[model samples]
Structure formats: C-alpha cells, structure tokens
Target: MMRAADLPGVIPVFPLPGALLLPRARLPLHLFEPRYLAMLDDVLKTPHRLIGMVQPDPNPRAAQEDAPPPLHSIGCAGRVTQFSETEDGRYMITLAGISRFRVTEEVGGFCPYRRVKPSWEGFDRDLARSEKDTGFKRESFLDLLSRYFQAKSLDTDWETLKEADDEMLINSLSMLLSFDPEEKQALLEAPSLSTRRETLVTLIEYALRGGDDHGLLQ
Candidate 1:
C-alpha cells in the first residue's frame, strides 16, 4: 500500500542470519524477542509498515565476541501485510518484500530495535512483480536441482517447482535452500534474475561436490 517515494531514509532493521526475503516474496516471522515485538508494534503504527530484513555479517574481521555482529550492507525492505497477536504476547506476521536497499549508515537511537539510513538508489526496479530471465532453461535446471536435492536427502514436488515462473522458481529456491548465510547473502545481492540463477546453479553444483564454501566466491 506504500508508494516508492513514501519510503523513509531511515528504517528499522531485523538482522537474522540465513533468512532471505527477495522482492515480491513473503517472509513469515514469529516475534517473541522483546525488541522485535516492539519493532512490530512501532512499524504497525506507521503508514509504510516496513522493516529491513538483513543478515548478520559473517566475516570474522567484522565481528567481536563482546559486541553484536555487524550487519551486511545490502538488504530487502518488506512491508507487513498480515499480523496477529498470540495469546502468549508474541506476534506472527508476514512481510511482503518491496525493494532492496543498502545500509548507508547505522542510526543511533533510543528505540529498542536497530535502525539504519537506507539508500534505495539501485533497486527501484524491484517494485515490479518479476523480470525475464532470458537465459533460463527450465528442464536442465530441474535435472540439476533433482540431483542436488537427492544428495541432501530433501524431498520436493517436482511439478510445483516446474510450474513456477522464472523469477519465482529462482527466488523461492534461493530463499528456501539450506545454503549458508554467506551464499544466501550472495543470492540476495545478485544484480539480476539471470545472475541469481547462475549463482544458484553454481552453488548446487558445489554442494553436490561436498560444498566448497571457499570456492563459491570465485
């Protein structure tokens, strides 16, 4: 319901590792932590009702045992589209992803939740529902996916996966797969649908070969 121009310069952030929310996808979150519960309450009072879904930066150099881990620079902002309060005082909510943003800087505030100044310059196109991945060849990709899933001892409906469009098939897999945090970040930061698909293929190929995390960046 919020327009692109209405997005704020500074927004609240939730830095949970391994959670990937791509544009046009919905991420369901169960909020029990006091800070995040407060974050949900505060955002619901706003017109935009959005929060940045970012991952904790996994690089050892960016972290210290005594302090909170640094957040990755890039993340997607999602608007809360559904909400319900549980009897236990927790919140169950669904976020409909709007666009990706880069963390320009962390804002110091008294609010319990983290906030960051977001730069939404390069991701305006994310407002659209989907994009064409001209290079996507469905049949072969599914074959590779079958092999990877079998190796991981995972089961999925081949028909369901095959029926998804280019963007949905790629983004859903990118979000749902059990890839490491760094790889999930890479998928979230991919410049286009084609790039994400290629990265996904490369990842699955590596996982089939016993998962060389070091070589994924190469």
Candidate 2:
C-alpha cells in the first residue's frame, strides 16, 4: 500500500506516445536510448526506484521544436520491479504500477531526462483495488477483441486471458491495444476503473466496425 506522502515530490518522466500505463498494471520497457538508459541508471541507485510514464503531446508543432515536447498532464508512476542488462548494452526492465498522478509542474535541471512535481492527492483511490465489478460488458468486449485480433492477424492465448481478473483483463487489453496517442491518454486519465472499461469497449467496437483509426486522435 502506497500513501500519498510516500510518493516523491519530484520524479523522472518518460514521455512516449501511444504507450499507456495504468495503476496496478505492468509495463515492460526496452531501454536502449541513451537518455532513458541514464534515467534508469539513476533510478536504480536511488531508494525509490520509481519512474513516471507519460505521453507526449500529439501536435505536430511540438515535435518540430528543439525543446522537449509537451506532455499530457496525467501519468502513472511505477516501481522498477525487474531489470536485466543485455549483452548489447540494452536494458530490459519491468515496471509495476503504483499510482496515477497529475503533473503540477516541470522542473528544469541539467539532467538529460525530464522531471516533474507530481500531485497524487486526487488520485489516492488508485492505491486501492479497483471495484470488483467494473460493470464492463465482458462478453461483448471479448467478442470485439476477438474480431479485432483476427482483423490484425494477432494471436493470443485465450486460456490465459480467461484466467485474468476483471481489473487485469481491462488494464491488459487497454495497454496491449494499438490505440492512437490521444486515445491512450484518455484511458490513462479516466476518472475511474469503470469509466476506463467503458472507454476501452467503445474503442474496440469502433475498431471492429472498420472505423478510420486516424479519426481517433481527433
């Protein structure tokens, strides 16, 4: 159980587009980029092996600028639960999600990676187990997922998926799906588990109906 006070006032952030991390979810990352590798190294030396996963703004102008791209306000903080170094000097790491936070402000520093002050006050409920009954339309959601998988020619282990609890299934599907950056951010910023589930179902349905994926960013 993590209390709001236990969370650091400032933490390193990795702004990746289309990547979503939800509370209590797990995100596996490949850290080959120099800046991220340095961030990982610093985090490993600290007592709080934590990192915030955020998504970069989708605006084209943000990418054209020399400065760091703007980031979405909400993100999930995760602890470095597993790590290994590859022979090629790359890092394989797994982050176990802790809680969701809102970025209060960005801190300027000499470090290559960006850091921000996180406000966890409004997201304290993320520390607890999500409601057991997410009110998700499980059967319809699964049916749509199956269709979408077939459409994408993706394979999955149905048995394993069936064994997952409600929260795990929802979060896993949300992370695994190839949603647009804005859609991913919307899921990350959803006010509650049930709301996230509903949004996910809608997305899956839209995909199944052969809706234009590009329109999702709007």
Candidate 3:
C-alpha cells in the first residue's frame, strides 16, 4: 500500500485511448515509439519507475488541435514490474497498477512526453481491497459473457475464468473486452468495485442486445 506522500507528485503519462489499467491489475506494454521509449529510459533511472496510463478525449475538436489530444481527468499509475530490452531496441514491459489519480494541472513544455501533478486524495480506496461484501451476479455475468464470446468468436478457458475471484473477473473482463474508449474510461472512473461491476454488467448487456458497433470485435 502506498501512502499519499509516497506517491509521485508528477508522473509521465502514456495517453493511449481505450487502453485501461486498474489498480492491482497488470498491463503489458510494448514501448516502441521514440517518445515512449525515451519515457521508459527516464523512468528506469528514477526510484519510482511509475507511468500514468490515461486516455485521450475522443472529441473531434480536441483531436484537431495542434497540441496533444486532451486527456481525461483520471488515470491509473503503474509501476514497471517487468522490463526487458529487445535486440531491436524496443522495450517489453509489464506495469503493475498502483493507484488512480486525477490530473490537477499539466506541467508542459519540459519533457517530450506529458507530465502532470496528480491528486490521489479522492482515490485512497484504490490502495486497499473493497471490504463491502457487494455481491456479484456471477452466473448471470458468466452467461452473458459466454454469449458475448460466441458473438465475437473469441476463445477463452472457461475453467480458468470460473476460478478467478470476483475482483479479478470484473477487472479482467473490463480490460479484455473490446469496449469503446469512452466506455473503458467510464470503467476506470467508476467510484467503487461494485459500481464498476455493475457498469460492466450493463455494458455487456448492451452489447448482447446489439446496441453499438463499437462493442463488436475491433
């Protein structure tokens, strides 16, 4: 568990739209782009070795601007838990999520990659497991999930999925499913584990009913 003070005041951000990382989850990344490769190199020398995974706002106006695309206010910070340099000079790394943070202000024109002062005060719950015995509709979720897999022609080890704990199941599905950027961001910003689970269920149900082309395999 990281205390508030222990968290970095400013962290480098990787603004990947639709890629989401939740606290206690692991997100594997291939760092090939020059700016990101440089970001990782700088992180290696620092003690924190942390990177913020944020999503770029999808508005067309935001995209048309000369500056980098605007980012959502919230994102999860992850520690570089695994790292290896390939002969081709690309970095293969796995980040273990630490906590969620809200960007208070962007500190610009310094690093090639973006940096922000993050506020961790509102997301202390991310540091600890949820104590609320918020029950999950496992059978219903799995049933809909099975339908979703079949619809998308996706394969999975049902035995392993069944064995996953509640938190793991919810977070894993949230990460693995091909949701739109806004939907993924909504999951990341959910106030609690229970709320995320509920939101996931609603999204899955919407997909099952053929609500949006974005929910289909992409």
Candidate of highest lDDT: 1
Question: Each candidate's lDDT (Cα)?
Answer: 0.90, 0.86, 0.87
Poorest lDDT segment (10 consecutive residues) of candidate 2: 129-138
Full-model lDDT, candidate 2: 0.86
Task: Evaluate model 2: give its TM-score.
Answer: 0.92
Q: Model 3: runs farther than 4 Å from truth?
A: 60-65, 130-133, 214-218
Predicted structure with the largest TM-score when compared to the true one? 1
Clashing pairs in 3: none
* Candidate 1 lDDT for residue 149: 88
lDDT of 3 by residue, 1-218 (tens): 56667798889999998899999889999999999999999998988899999998766665654777788889999999999999999999999888999998888876888999998888888888743426887787789899989988999999999998888888888998988988998899989889898889888888878886474322
Give me candidate 1's TM-score against the actual structure: 0.94
TM-scores for every candidate against the unseen true structure: 0.94, 0.92, 0.92
Question: After best superposition, candidate 1 residue 106: deviation in angstroms?
Answer: 0.8
Which regions of candidate 1 are displaced past 4 Å?
Answer: 63-67, 212-215
